[model samples]
Target: MRAVIATEPGGPEVLTVTEIADPEIGPGEVLLDVAAAGLNRADLLQRQGFYPPPPGASDVIGMECSGTVAAVGPDVTGWSVGDQACALLAGGGYAERVAVPAGQLMPVPDGVDLVTAAAIPEVAATVWSNVFMVAGLQPQETLLVHGGAGGIGSFAIQLAHQLGSRVVTTAGSADKLAACTALGADVAINYRDQDFVEVVAEQTDGGVDVILDNMGAKYLDRNIDALRTQGRLVIIGMQGGTKAELDINKLLRKRGAVIATNLRGRPVEEKSAICASVVQHVWPLVAEGLVQPIVGRSFPLAEAGAAHAYMESGDHSGKILLTV
Candidate 1:
Protein backbone atom coordinates (compact mmCIF):
# COMPACT_ATOMS: atom_id res chain seq x y z
CA MET A 1 0.00 0.00 0.00
CA ARG A 2 1.10 3.58 -0.56
CA ALA A 3 0.70 5.92 2.39
CA VAL A 4 1.52 9.53 3.22
CA ILE A 5 3.59 10.44 6.24
CA ALA A 6 5.45 13.53 7.40
CA THR A 7 9.21 12.90 7.08
CA GLU A 8 9.63 15.27 9.98
CA PRO A 9 7.47 17.66 11.94
CA GLY A 10 7.66 20.75 9.74
CA GLY A 11 5.86 22.28 6.76
CA PRO A 12 3.98 20.77 3.83
CA GLU A 13 7.36 19.97 2.29
CA VAL A 14 7.83 17.29 4.94
CA LEU A 15 4.94 15.22 3.59
CA THR A 16 5.90 12.31 1.38
CA VAL A 17 4.12 9.31 -0.09
CA THR A 18 5.87 5.97 0.00
CA GLU A 19 5.22 2.26 0.09
CA ILE A 20 3.93 0.91 3.41
CA ALA A 21 2.48 -2.36 4.60
CA ASP A 22 -1.29 -2.71 4.28
CA PRO A 23 -3.07 -2.37 7.59
CA GLU A 24 -4.61 -5.45 9.16
CA ILE A 25 -8.14 -5.17 10.46
CA GLY A 26 -8.97 -5.92 14.07
CA PRO A 27 -12.18 -7.43 15.41
CA GLY A 28 -15.18 -5.25 14.63
CA GLU A 29 -13.13 -3.41 11.96
CA VAL A 30 -13.20 -3.37 8.19
CA LEU A 31 -10.43 -2.97 5.64
CA LEU A 32 -11.16 -0.45 2.93
CA ASP A 33 -9.53 -0.01 -0.45
CA VAL A 34 -9.68 3.73 -0.33
CA ALA A 35 -10.94 5.71 -3.32
CA ALA A 36 -10.17 9.14 -1.85
CA ALA A 37 -9.32 10.96 1.35
CA GLY A 38 -10.43 14.31 2.77
CA LEU A 39 -7.91 16.97 3.76
CA ASN A 40 -8.57 18.78 7.01
CA ARG A 41 -7.00 21.61 9.03
CA ALA A 42 -6.00 19.01 11.63
CA ASP A 43 -3.96 17.21 8.97
CA LEU A 44 -1.91 20.36 8.57
CA LEU A 45 -1.46 20.60 12.32
CA GLN A 46 -0.26 17.00 12.42
CA ARG A 47 2.20 17.64 9.57
CA GLN A 48 3.52 20.65 11.51
CA GLY A 49 4.08 18.46 14.62
CA PHE A 50 1.32 20.06 16.65
CA TYR A 51 -1.50 17.47 16.60
CA PRO A 52 -0.73 13.77 17.04
CA PRO A 53 -3.22 11.00 16.51
CA PRO A 54 -4.94 9.55 19.55
CA PRO A 55 -3.18 6.77 21.47
CA GLY A 56 -2.83 3.57 19.37
CA ALA A 57 -4.17 5.28 16.20
CA SER A 58 -2.32 5.13 12.88
CA ASP A 59 0.28 7.84 12.38
CA VAL A 60 -0.84 8.59 8.82
CA ILE A 61 -2.34 12.08 8.63
CA GLY A 62 -5.87 11.86 7.25
CA MET A 63 -9.14 11.95 9.19
CA GLU A 64 -11.86 10.89 6.76
CA CYS A 65 -12.25 8.98 3.50
CA SER A 66 -14.57 7.18 1.07
CA GLY A 67 -13.81 3.66 -0.10
CA THR A 68 -15.03 0.15 -0.80
CA VAL A 69 -14.87 -2.53 1.84
CA ALA A 70 -12.28 -5.14 0.93
CA ALA A 71 -12.84 -7.30 4.00
CA VAL A 72 -14.53 -7.33 7.38
CA GLY A 73 -13.03 -8.56 10.64
CA PRO A 74 -14.56 -10.82 13.22
CA ASP A 75 -17.57 -9.44 15.11
CA VAL A 76 -18.43 -6.95 12.36
CA THR A 77 -21.80 -7.24 10.64
CA GLY A 78 -24.10 -5.23 8.37
CA TRP A 79 -21.17 -4.56 6.00
CA SER A 80 -19.51 -6.86 3.49
CA VAL A 81 -17.00 -6.96 0.70
CA GLY A 82 -17.68 -4.39 -2.06
CA ASP A 83 -19.84 -2.12 0.10
CA GLN A 84 -19.33 1.56 -0.75
CA ALA A 85 -19.04 3.82 2.28
CA CYS A 86 -17.48 6.90 3.72
CA ALA A 87 -15.83 6.73 7.14
CA LEU A 88 -14.73 8.81 10.08
CA LEU A 89 -11.25 7.86 11.23
CA ALA A 90 -8.81 8.75 13.92
CA GLY A 91 -5.97 8.43 11.39
CA GLY A 92 -4.64 6.45 8.35
CA GLY A 93 -6.99 7.92 5.72
CA TYR A 94 -4.08 9.15 3.59
CA ALA A 95 -3.36 5.72 2.22
CA GLU A 96 -4.40 3.25 -0.45
CA ARG A 97 -5.91 1.04 2.23
CA VAL A 98 -7.17 1.83 5.73
CA ALA A 99 -8.64 -0.34 8.46
CA VAL A 100 -11.68 1.29 10.06
CA PRO A 101 -13.93 0.36 12.95
CA ALA A 102 -17.12 -0.87 11.29
CA GLY A 103 -19.08 1.43 13.55
CA GLN A 104 -17.47 4.49 11.94
CA LEU A 105 -18.69 3.68 8.46
CA MET A 106 -21.61 5.50 6.83
CA PRO A 107 -23.37 4.62 3.60
CA VAL A 108 -22.74 7.05 0.76
CA PRO A 109 -25.73 9.30 0.37
CA ASP A 110 -27.98 8.60 -2.64
CA GLY A 111 -26.60 11.29 -4.95
CA VAL A 112 -22.90 11.57 -3.95
CA ASP A 113 -20.12 10.03 -5.97
CA LEU A 114 -17.33 8.03 -4.35
CA VAL A 115 -14.69 10.78 -4.54
CA THR A 116 -17.20 13.39 -3.39
CA ALA A 117 -18.33 11.18 -0.51
CA ALA A 118 -14.79 11.49 0.82
CA ALA A 119 -15.50 15.13 1.58
CA ILE A 120 -18.65 14.57 3.63
CA PRO A 121 -17.85 12.46 6.72
CA GLU A 122 -15.67 14.77 8.76
CA VAL A 123 -17.59 17.96 8.04
CA ALA A 124 -20.99 16.32 8.43
CA ALA A 125 -20.12 14.56 11.67
CA THR A 126 -18.50 17.69 13.06
CA VAL A 127 -21.33 20.03 12.17
CA TRP A 128 -24.12 17.64 13.07
CA SER A 129 -22.66 16.63 16.43
CA ASN A 130 -21.63 20.11 17.47
CA VAL A 131 -24.44 22.31 16.17
CA PHE A 132 -27.43 20.00 16.46
CA MET A 133 -26.65 17.41 19.13
CA VAL A 134 -24.40 19.37 21.44
CA ALA A 135 -25.72 22.92 21.16
CA GLY A 136 -29.30 21.89 20.36
CA LEU A 137 -29.95 24.41 17.58
CA GLN A 138 -33.69 24.60 16.89
CA PRO A 139 -35.97 25.67 14.10
CA GLN A 140 -36.73 29.43 14.07
CA GLU A 141 -33.57 30.05 16.13
CA THR A 142 -30.56 31.94 14.76
CA LEU A 143 -27.09 30.39 14.39
CA LEU A 144 -23.70 31.91 13.57
CA VAL A 145 -20.81 30.02 11.99
CA HIS A 146 -17.24 31.22 11.74
CA GLY A 147 -14.99 30.61 8.72
CA GLY A 148 -18.12 30.08 6.66
CA ALA A 149 -16.22 29.23 3.47
CA GLY A 150 -14.41 26.27 4.98
CA GLY A 151 -15.67 22.69 5.06
CA ILE A 152 -17.30 22.55 8.49
CA GLY A 153 -18.71 26.04 8.23
CA SER A 154 -20.12 25.49 4.76
CA PHE A 155 -21.94 22.34 5.83
CA ALA A 156 -23.15 24.01 9.02
CA ILE A 157 -24.62 26.85 6.99
CA GLN A 158 -26.50 24.53 4.67
CA LEU A 159 -27.75 22.13 7.35
CA ALA A 160 -28.89 24.88 9.69
CA HIS A 161 -30.59 26.75 6.89
CA GLN A 162 -32.32 23.69 5.52
CA LEU A 163 -33.50 22.76 9.00
CA GLY A 164 -35.14 26.20 9.39
CA SER A 165 -32.55 28.06 11.47
CA ARG A 166 -31.66 31.58 10.36
CA VAL A 167 -27.94 31.39 9.62
CA VAL A 168 -25.29 34.13 9.87
CA THR A 169 -21.72 33.44 8.85
CA THR A 170 -18.34 35.20 8.48
CA ALA A 171 -16.00 34.95 5.53
CA GLY A 172 -12.83 36.81 4.48
CA SER A 173 -13.78 38.01 1.01
CA ALA A 174 -16.72 39.22 -1.05
CA ASP A 175 -16.83 36.14 -3.27
CA LYS A 176 -16.64 33.85 -0.28
CA LEU A 177 -19.43 35.84 1.36
CA ALA A 178 -21.53 35.45 -1.76
CA ALA A 179 -20.88 31.72 -1.74
CA CYS A 180 -21.94 31.49 1.87
CA THR A 181 -25.11 33.43 1.11
CA ALA A 182 -25.83 31.09 -1.77
CA LEU A 183 -25.44 28.16 0.61
CA GLY A 184 -28.20 29.63 2.81
CA ALA A 185 -26.60 32.11 5.17
CA ASP A 186 -29.12 34.82 5.88
CA VAL A 187 -26.24 37.28 6.40
CA ALA A 188 -22.58 36.85 5.52
CA ILE A 189 -20.17 39.26 7.18
CA ASN A 190 -16.77 39.96 5.67
CA TYR A 191 -14.60 39.35 8.73
CA ARG A 192 -11.80 41.48 7.28
CA ASP A 193 -13.87 44.67 7.47
CA GLN A 194 -17.05 44.15 9.43
CA ASP A 195 -17.52 43.41 13.10
CA PHE A 196 -19.34 40.08 13.15
CA VAL A 197 -20.65 40.69 16.63
CA GLU A 198 -22.52 43.73 15.46
CA VAL A 199 -23.79 42.15 12.26
CA VAL A 200 -24.99 39.13 14.21
CA ALA A 201 -26.83 41.42 16.61
CA GLU A 202 -28.49 43.34 13.78
CA GLN A 203 -29.41 40.20 11.85
CA THR A 204 -30.98 38.45 14.79
CA ASP A 205 -33.24 40.29 17.25
CA GLY A 206 -30.51 40.60 19.88
CA GLY A 207 -27.89 37.92 19.38
CA VAL A 208 -27.73 34.44 17.87
CA ASP A 209 -29.21 31.44 19.65
CA VAL A 210 -26.12 29.35 18.97
CA ILE A 211 -22.64 29.96 17.56
CA LEU A 212 -20.46 27.23 15.99
CA ASP A 213 -17.02 28.76 16.46
CA ASN A 214 -13.61 27.54 15.36
CA MET A 215 -11.57 30.70 16.09
CA GLY A 216 -11.19 29.84 19.79
CA ALA A 217 -9.68 32.48 22.09
CA LYS A 218 -9.68 35.28 19.55
CA TYR A 219 -13.46 35.23 19.40
CA LEU A 220 -14.19 34.24 23.00
CA ASP A 221 -15.01 37.68 24.40
CA ARG A 222 -17.00 38.84 21.42
CA ASN A 223 -18.69 35.46 21.07
CA ILE A 224 -20.04 35.90 24.58
CA ASP A 225 -21.26 39.37 23.69
CA ALA A 226 -23.00 38.02 20.59
CA LEU A 227 -25.01 35.39 22.42
CA ARG A 228 -28.75 35.68 23.05
CA THR A 229 -30.10 34.84 26.50
CA GLN A 230 -29.38 31.22 27.34
CA GLY A 231 -27.42 30.83 24.13
CA ARG A 232 -24.94 28.01 23.54
CA LEU A 233 -21.44 28.49 22.12
CA VAL A 234 -19.69 25.38 20.82
CA ILE A 235 -15.96 25.80 20.17
CA ILE A 236 -14.42 23.05 18.02
CA GLY A 237 -11.12 24.53 16.81
CA MET A 238 -8.48 27.05 17.81
CA GLN A 239 -7.52 28.54 14.46
CA GLY A 240 -7.20 32.00 16.03
CA GLY A 241 -5.12 30.89 19.05
CA THR A 242 -5.92 28.89 22.20
CA LYS A 243 -6.07 31.10 25.23
CA ALA A 244 -8.12 34.17 26.11
CA GLU A 245 -9.99 35.80 28.93
CA LEU A 246 -13.68 35.15 29.30
CA ASP A 247 -16.08 37.63 30.88
CA ILE A 248 -17.87 35.57 33.46
CA ASN A 249 -20.17 38.39 34.53
CA LYS A 250 -21.46 38.90 31.01
CA LEU A 251 -22.03 35.16 30.47
CA LEU A 252 -23.76 34.94 33.80
CA ARG A 253 -26.08 37.77 32.87
CA LYS A 254 -27.04 36.07 29.63
CA ARG A 255 -27.02 32.57 31.13
CA GLY A 256 -24.94 31.31 28.23
CA ALA A 257 -23.01 28.07 28.04
CA VAL A 258 -19.59 27.54 26.41
CA ILE A 259 -18.55 24.08 25.24
CA ALA A 260 -15.20 23.10 23.74
CA THR A 261 -15.05 19.70 21.93
CA ASN A 262 -12.92 17.53 19.69
CA LEU A 263 -14.25 14.77 17.44
CA ARG A 264 -11.08 12.86 16.70
CA GLY A 265 -10.18 11.70 20.19
CA ARG A 266 -13.54 10.23 21.03
CA PRO A 267 -14.14 6.55 21.85
CA VAL A 268 -15.40 4.30 19.06
CA GLU A 269 -18.82 3.84 20.62
CA GLU A 270 -19.29 7.61 20.82
CA LYS A 271 -18.10 8.08 17.24
CA SER A 272 -20.39 5.26 16.17
CA ALA A 273 -23.34 7.05 17.78
CA ILE A 274 -22.50 10.30 16.04
CA CYS A 275 -22.11 8.50 12.72
CA ALA A 276 -25.45 6.81 13.20
CA SER A 277 -27.13 10.11 14.05
CA VAL A 278 -25.64 11.79 10.97
CA VAL A 279 -26.75 8.96 8.71
CA GLN A 280 -30.25 9.18 10.12
CA HIS A 281 -30.62 12.97 10.35
CA VAL A 282 -28.25 14.47 7.77
CA TRP A 283 -28.01 11.86 4.99
CA PRO A 284 -31.68 12.27 4.11
CA LEU A 285 -31.11 15.97 3.47
CA VAL A 286 -28.28 15.03 1.14
CA ALA A 287 -30.41 12.36 -0.53
CA GLU A 288 -33.13 14.98 -1.08
CA GLY A 289 -30.63 17.48 -2.53
CA LEU A 290 -31.30 19.89 0.32
CA VAL A 291 -27.61 19.65 1.25
CA GLN A 292 -24.67 18.66 -0.91
CA PRO A 293 -20.99 17.86 -0.63
CA ILE A 294 -18.96 20.94 -1.50
CA VAL A 295 -15.58 19.94 -2.88
CA GLY A 296 -13.21 22.72 -3.91
CA ARG A 297 -10.54 20.60 -5.60
CA SER A 298 -8.70 17.29 -5.62
CA PHE A 299 -5.16 16.06 -6.11
CA PRO A 300 -3.74 12.67 -6.92
CA LEU A 301 -2.85 10.75 -3.77
CA ALA A 302 0.85 11.06 -4.52
CA GLU A 303 0.47 14.84 -4.54
CA ALA A 304 -0.62 15.00 -0.90
CA GLY A 305 2.15 17.48 -0.20
CA ALA A 306 0.87 19.91 -2.82
CA ALA A 307 -2.65 19.46 -1.46
CA HIS A 308 -1.42 20.50 1.98
CA ALA A 309 0.30 23.54 0.50
CA TYR A 310 -2.90 24.52 -1.31
CA MET A 311 -5.05 24.27 1.81
CA GLU A 312 -2.50 26.34 3.75
CA SER A 313 -2.73 29.04 1.07
CA GLY A 314 -6.26 29.83 2.42
CA ASP A 315 -7.54 30.41 -1.13
CA HIS A 316 -9.81 27.40 -1.47
CA SER A 317 -13.39 26.95 -0.26
CA GLY A 318 -15.14 23.75 0.82
CA LYS A 319 -13.27 20.47 1.20
CA ILE A 320 -9.98 19.48 -0.50
CA LEU A 321 -9.52 15.82 -1.43
CA LEU A 322 -6.76 13.34 -2.31
CA THR A 323 -7.92 10.77 -4.85
CA VAL A 324 -6.36 7.36 -4.58
Candidate 2:
Protein backbone atom coordinates (compact mmCIF):
# COMPACT_ATOMS: atom_id res chain seq x y z
CA MET A 1 0.00 0.00 0.00
CA ARG A 2 1.15 3.56 -0.66
CA ALA A 3 1.06 5.80 2.40
CA VAL A 4 2.11 9.29 3.38
CA ILE A 5 4.41 9.13 6.36
CA ALA A 6 5.62 12.12 8.33
CA THR A 7 9.33 11.53 8.65
CA GLU A 8 10.14 13.60 11.76
CA PRO A 9 7.52 16.28 11.52
CA GLY A 10 8.43 19.91 10.96
CA GLY A 11 6.87 21.19 7.75
CA PRO A 12 4.82 20.05 4.75
CA GLU A 13 8.08 18.87 3.21
CA VAL A 14 8.13 16.05 5.72
CA LEU A 15 5.33 14.08 4.07
CA THR A 16 6.81 11.23 2.03
CA VAL A 17 5.07 8.64 -0.11
CA THR A 18 6.36 5.10 0.29
CA GLU A 19 5.25 1.54 -0.16
CA ILE A 20 4.30 0.13 3.25
CA ALA A 21 2.62 -2.98 4.56
CA ASP A 22 -1.14 -2.69 4.46
CA PRO A 23 -2.79 -2.06 7.79
CA GLU A 24 -4.32 -5.27 9.10
CA ILE A 25 -8.00 -5.29 10.00
CA GLY A 26 -9.05 -6.11 13.51
CA PRO A 27 -12.31 -7.63 14.71
CA GLY A 28 -15.23 -5.30 13.99
CA GLU A 29 -13.09 -3.43 11.44
CA VAL A 30 -13.46 -3.06 7.70
CA LEU A 31 -10.84 -2.56 4.98
CA LEU A 32 -11.59 0.28 2.57
CA ASP A 33 -10.27 1.02 -0.91
CA VAL A 34 -10.16 4.74 -0.19
CA ALA A 35 -11.47 7.06 -2.88
CA ALA A 36 -10.82 10.26 -0.96
CA ALA A 37 -9.77 11.67 2.39
CA GLY A 38 -10.42 15.03 4.02
CA LEU A 39 -7.59 17.36 5.02
CA ASN A 40 -8.06 19.11 8.35
CA ARG A 41 -6.14 21.78 10.21
CA ALA A 42 -5.38 19.13 12.79
CA ASP A 43 -3.46 17.20 10.16
CA LEU A 44 -1.18 20.20 9.66
CA LEU A 45 -0.72 20.54 13.39
CA GLN A 46 0.15 16.87 13.70
CA ARG A 47 2.68 17.08 10.88
CA GLN A 48 4.40 20.01 12.59
CA GLY A 49 4.75 18.06 15.83
CA PHE A 50 2.23 20.22 17.67
CA TYR A 51 -0.42 17.49 17.93
CA PRO A 52 0.07 13.73 18.16
CA PRO A 53 -2.45 11.03 17.48
CA PRO A 54 -4.28 9.92 20.62
CA PRO A 55 -3.02 6.85 22.48
CA GLY A 56 -3.42 3.59 20.55
CA ALA A 57 -4.30 5.41 17.28
CA SER A 58 -2.49 5.24 13.94
CA ASP A 59 0.32 7.73 13.45
CA VAL A 60 -0.79 8.69 9.93
CA ILE A 61 -2.34 12.14 9.66
CA GLY A 62 -5.76 11.61 8.04
CA MET A 63 -8.91 12.04 10.10
CA GLU A 64 -11.74 11.15 7.72
CA CYS A 65 -12.18 9.12 4.54
CA SER A 66 -14.85 7.92 2.06
CA GLY A 67 -14.61 4.73 0.05
CA THR A 68 -15.97 1.26 -0.65
CA VAL A 69 -15.65 -1.63 1.71
CA ALA A 70 -13.07 -4.04 0.31
CA ALA A 71 -13.69 -6.60 3.04
CA VAL A 72 -15.14 -6.93 6.52
CA GLY A 73 -13.55 -8.41 9.61
CA PRO A 74 -14.83 -11.68 10.96
CA ASP A 75 -16.92 -10.16 13.75
CA VAL A 76 -18.53 -7.43 11.62
CA THR A 77 -22.18 -7.80 10.62
CA GLY A 78 -24.81 -5.78 8.73
CA TRP A 79 -22.13 -4.09 6.57
CA SER A 80 -20.99 -6.37 3.76
CA VAL A 81 -18.31 -5.90 1.13
CA GLY A 82 -18.81 -3.12 -1.46
CA ASP A 83 -20.92 -0.70 0.58
CA GLN A 84 -20.26 2.99 -0.17
CA ALA A 85 -19.24 4.34 3.23
CA CYS A 86 -17.46 7.22 4.91
CA ALA A 87 -15.71 7.05 8.24
CA LEU A 88 -14.19 9.26 10.92
CA LEU A 89 -10.65 8.11 11.56
CA ALA A 90 -8.35 8.71 14.50
CA GLY A 91 -5.47 8.45 12.00
CA GLY A 92 -4.22 6.61 8.85
CA GLY A 93 -6.42 8.35 6.25
CA TYR A 94 -3.45 9.54 4.11
CA ALA A 95 -3.04 6.21 2.43
CA GLU A 96 -4.25 4.08 -0.46
CA ARG A 97 -6.32 2.00 1.94
CA VAL A 98 -7.31 2.26 5.61
CA ALA A 99 -8.81 -0.09 8.17
CA VAL A 100 -11.75 1.54 9.98
CA PRO A 101 -13.65 0.23 12.95
CA ALA A 102 -17.16 -0.66 11.79
CA GLY A 103 -18.56 1.47 14.60
CA GLN A 104 -17.00 4.60 13.12
CA LEU A 105 -18.39 4.21 9.60
CA MET A 106 -21.62 5.54 8.01
CA PRO A 107 -23.24 4.77 4.66
CA VAL A 108 -22.89 7.59 2.16
CA PRO A 109 -26.12 9.34 1.20
CA ASP A 110 -27.65 8.55 -2.17
CA GLY A 111 -26.58 10.87 -5.03
CA VAL A 112 -23.45 12.03 -3.19
CA ASP A 113 -20.11 11.15 -4.73
CA LEU A 114 -17.35 9.37 -2.85
CA VAL A 115 -15.04 12.40 -2.85
CA THR A 116 -17.64 14.72 -1.32
CA ALA A 117 -18.62 12.08 1.18
CA ALA A 118 -15.02 12.18 2.41
CA ALA A 119 -15.56 15.83 3.25
CA ILE A 120 -18.61 15.23 5.44
CA PRO A 121 -17.71 12.91 8.33
CA GLU A 122 -15.33 15.03 10.36
CA VAL A 123 -17.22 18.30 9.91
CA ALA A 124 -20.57 16.63 10.53
CA ALA A 125 -19.45 14.76 13.63
CA THR A 126 -17.61 17.77 15.00
CA VAL A 127 -20.39 20.34 14.61
CA TRP A 128 -23.20 17.94 15.55
CA SER A 129 -21.51 16.68 18.70
CA ASN A 130 -20.33 20.08 19.85
CA VAL A 131 -22.90 22.73 18.87
CA PHE A 132 -25.94 20.44 18.95
CA MET A 133 -25.17 17.67 21.42
CA VAL A 134 -23.06 19.54 23.94
CA ALA A 135 -24.15 23.18 23.61
CA GLY A 136 -27.80 22.40 22.91
CA LEU A 137 -28.44 25.23 20.43
CA GLN A 138 -32.22 25.83 20.36
CA PRO A 139 -34.50 26.99 17.56
CA GLN A 140 -35.16 30.76 17.49
CA GLU A 141 -32.04 31.39 19.54
CA THR A 142 -29.13 33.39 18.15
CA LEU A 143 -25.95 31.41 17.26
CA LEU A 144 -22.54 32.94 16.58
CA VAL A 145 -19.89 30.91 14.74
CA HIS A 146 -16.27 31.94 14.28
CA GLY A 147 -14.34 31.33 11.01
CA GLY A 148 -17.66 31.12 9.17
CA ALA A 149 -16.16 30.02 5.83
CA GLY A 150 -13.93 27.31 7.18
CA GLY A 151 -14.75 23.60 7.29
CA ILE A 152 -16.47 23.19 10.65
CA GLY A 153 -17.81 26.75 10.72
CA SER A 154 -19.53 26.39 7.34
CA PHE A 155 -21.25 23.24 8.49
CA ALA A 156 -22.25 24.89 11.76
CA ILE A 157 -23.79 27.81 9.91
CA GLN A 158 -25.95 25.54 7.75
CA LEU A 159 -27.06 23.30 10.58
CA ALA A 160 -27.99 26.21 12.81
CA HIS A 161 -29.90 27.86 9.99
CA GLN A 162 -31.77 24.68 9.10
CA LEU A 163 -32.74 24.21 12.74
CA GLY A 164 -34.39 27.68 12.82
CA SER A 165 -31.65 29.51 14.70
CA ARG A 166 -30.70 33.05 13.70
CA VAL A 167 -27.02 32.73 12.81
CA VAL A 168 -24.19 35.25 13.10
CA THR A 169 -20.61 34.62 11.94
CA THR A 170 -17.22 36.37 12.05
CA ALA A 171 -14.58 36.01 9.35
CA GLY A 172 -11.45 37.99 8.45
CA SER A 173 -12.59 39.11 5.00
CA ALA A 174 -15.70 40.58 3.40
CA ASP A 175 -15.71 37.89 0.71
CA LYS A 176 -15.77 35.18 3.37
CA LEU A 177 -18.58 36.93 5.23
CA ALA A 178 -20.52 37.18 1.98
CA ALA A 179 -20.17 33.43 1.55
CA CYS A 180 -21.43 32.92 5.07
CA THR A 181 -24.48 35.09 4.37
CA ALA A 182 -25.30 32.99 1.34
CA LEU A 183 -25.28 29.96 3.60
CA GLY A 184 -28.14 31.50 5.64
CA ALA A 185 -26.13 33.43 8.22
CA ASP A 186 -28.39 36.28 9.34
CA VAL A 187 -25.47 38.48 10.50
CA ALA A 188 -21.94 38.28 9.09
CA ILE A 189 -19.16 40.50 10.36
CA ASN A 190 -15.64 41.01 9.08
CA TYR A 191 -13.53 40.34 12.15
CA ARG A 192 -10.57 42.27 10.73
CA ASP A 193 -12.57 45.47 10.30
CA GLN A 194 -14.78 45.40 13.42
CA ASP A 195 -15.04 43.92 16.84
CA PHE A 196 -17.56 41.08 16.80
CA VAL A 197 -18.64 41.89 20.33
CA GLU A 198 -20.20 45.19 19.24
CA VAL A 199 -21.61 43.81 16.01
CA VAL A 200 -23.24 40.86 17.74
CA ALA A 201 -24.54 42.97 20.62
CA GLU A 202 -26.15 45.39 18.19
CA GLN A 203 -27.81 42.61 16.21
CA THR A 204 -29.05 40.50 19.09
CA ASP A 205 -29.55 43.52 21.39
CA GLY A 206 -27.22 42.13 24.05
CA GLY A 207 -25.39 39.07 22.75
CA VAL A 208 -25.99 35.78 21.04
CA ASP A 209 -27.47 32.68 22.73
CA VAL A 210 -24.72 30.35 21.51
CA ILE A 211 -21.04 30.69 20.45
CA LEU A 212 -18.85 28.19 18.59
CA ASP A 213 -15.23 29.21 19.07
CA ASN A 214 -11.96 27.80 17.69
CA MET A 215 -9.77 30.71 18.73
CA GLY A 216 -8.88 29.80 22.27
CA ALA A 217 -6.99 32.41 24.30
CA LYS A 218 -7.31 35.28 21.83
CA TYR A 219 -11.11 35.18 21.75
CA LEU A 220 -11.72 34.01 25.31
CA ASP A 221 -12.53 37.39 26.79
CA ARG A 222 -14.38 38.70 23.75
CA ASN A 223 -16.39 35.52 23.41
CA ILE A 224 -17.68 35.92 26.94
CA ASP A 225 -18.62 39.53 26.22
CA ALA A 226 -20.60 38.44 23.14
CA LEU A 227 -22.82 35.88 24.88
CA ARG A 228 -26.36 36.57 26.09
CA THR A 229 -27.55 35.65 29.51
CA GLN A 230 -27.69 31.89 30.01
CA GLY A 231 -25.80 31.41 26.73
CA ARG A 232 -23.61 28.40 26.00
CA LEU A 233 -20.03 28.68 24.66
CA VAL A 234 -18.60 25.59 23.02
CA ILE A 235 -14.86 25.39 22.24
CA ILE A 236 -13.84 22.69 19.77
CA GLY A 237 -10.33 23.81 18.69
CA MET A 238 -7.63 26.21 19.78
CA GLN A 239 -6.22 27.96 16.75
CA GLY A 240 -4.98 30.73 18.99
CA GLY A 241 -2.49 30.29 21.82
CA THR A 242 -3.40 28.01 24.70
CA LYS A 243 -3.24 29.69 28.11
CA ALA A 244 -6.21 31.97 28.72
CA GLU A 245 -7.66 34.38 31.27
CA LEU A 246 -11.35 34.54 32.18
CA ASP A 247 -13.54 36.98 34.04
CA ILE A 248 -15.43 35.03 36.69
CA ASN A 249 -17.86 37.91 37.30
CA LYS A 250 -19.08 37.69 33.71
CA LEU A 251 -20.16 34.07 34.14
CA LEU A 252 -21.87 34.86 37.43
CA ARG A 253 -23.90 37.68 35.92
CA LYS A 254 -24.93 35.78 32.80
CA ARG A 255 -25.45 32.39 34.44
CA GLY A 256 -23.95 30.85 31.30
CA ALA A 257 -21.75 27.83 30.69
CA VAL A 258 -18.28 27.55 29.10
CA ILE A 259 -17.48 24.11 27.76
CA ALA A 260 -14.33 22.75 26.07
CA THR A 261 -14.48 19.63 23.93
CA ASN A 262 -12.57 17.41 21.46
CA LEU A 263 -14.12 14.58 19.47
CA ARG A 264 -11.07 12.63 18.27
CA GLY A 265 -9.91 11.52 21.68
CA ARG A 266 -13.25 10.16 22.78
CA PRO A 267 -13.86 6.51 23.70
CA VAL A 268 -15.22 4.15 21.05
CA GLU A 269 -18.64 3.91 22.69
CA GLU A 270 -19.11 7.68 22.53
CA LYS A 271 -17.97 7.87 18.88
CA SER A 272 -20.33 5.01 18.02
CA ALA A 273 -23.15 6.93 19.67
CA ILE A 274 -22.39 10.03 17.54
CA CYS A 275 -22.24 7.89 14.38
CA ALA A 276 -25.65 6.43 15.20
CA SER A 277 -27.12 9.88 15.78
CA VAL A 278 -25.83 11.10 12.40
CA VAL A 279 -27.22 8.04 10.62
CA GLN A 280 -30.67 8.49 12.14
CA HIS A 281 -30.96 12.30 12.14
CA VAL A 282 -28.44 14.08 9.91
CA TRP A 283 -28.51 11.51 7.12
CA PRO A 284 -32.14 12.37 6.37
CA LEU A 285 -31.22 16.01 5.73
CA VAL A 286 -28.47 14.88 3.39
CA ALA A 287 -30.74 12.45 1.55
CA GLU A 288 -33.42 15.14 1.15
CA GLY A 289 -30.90 17.58 -0.40
CA LEU A 290 -31.31 20.03 2.46
CA VAL A 291 -27.57 19.79 3.21
CA GLN A 292 -24.45 18.82 1.28
CA PRO A 293 -20.78 18.54 2.09
CA ILE A 294 -18.63 21.37 0.73
CA VAL A 295 -15.38 20.10 -0.76
CA GLY A 296 -13.21 23.09 -1.63
CA ARG A 297 -10.36 21.52 -3.59
CA SER A 298 -8.52 18.26 -4.11
CA PHE A 299 -4.95 17.02 -4.53
CA PRO A 300 -3.72 13.55 -5.31
CA LEU A 301 -2.23 11.37 -2.55
CA ALA A 302 1.36 12.12 -3.56
CA GLU A 303 0.69 15.84 -3.21
CA ALA A 304 -0.29 15.76 0.46
CA GLY A 305 2.43 18.34 1.04
CA ALA A 306 0.70 20.79 -1.28
CA ALA A 307 -2.59 20.16 0.49
CA HIS A 308 -1.00 21.08 3.81
CA ALA A 309 0.50 24.24 2.35
CA TYR A 310 -2.86 25.30 0.92
CA MET A 311 -4.64 24.85 4.23
CA GLU A 312 -1.92 26.78 6.07
CA SER A 313 -2.30 29.62 3.58
CA GLY A 314 -5.87 30.16 4.88
CA ASP A 315 -6.95 31.11 1.37
CA HIS A 316 -9.31 28.19 0.79
CA SER A 317 -12.90 27.80 1.92
CA GLY A 318 -14.82 24.65 2.87
CA LYS A 319 -13.00 21.33 3.15
CA ILE A 320 -9.72 20.42 1.34
CA LEU A 321 -9.66 16.84 0.09
CA LEU A 322 -6.89 14.39 -0.94
CA THR A 323 -7.89 11.78 -3.49
CA VAL A 324 -6.27 8.44 -2.72
Ten-residue stretch with the least lDDT total in model 2: 286-295
Clashes of 2: 0
Task: Give one digit per residue, the lDDT tens place, for model 2 in 233-287.
Answer: 9887788878898999998799989999888889888998998898887888888
**Candidate 1 lDDT, 1-324, residue by residue in tens:** 999999999988899999999999989999999999999999999999999999989999999999999999999999999999999999999999999999999999999999999999999999999999999999999999999999999999999999999999999999999999999999999999999988877778989999999989999999999999999999999989999998899999999999999999999999999999999999999999999989999999989999999999999999999999
Pairs in steric clash, model 1: none
| Runs off by more than 4 Å, candidate 1 | none
Clashing pairs in 2: none
Error of 2 at 322 (Å): 0.1
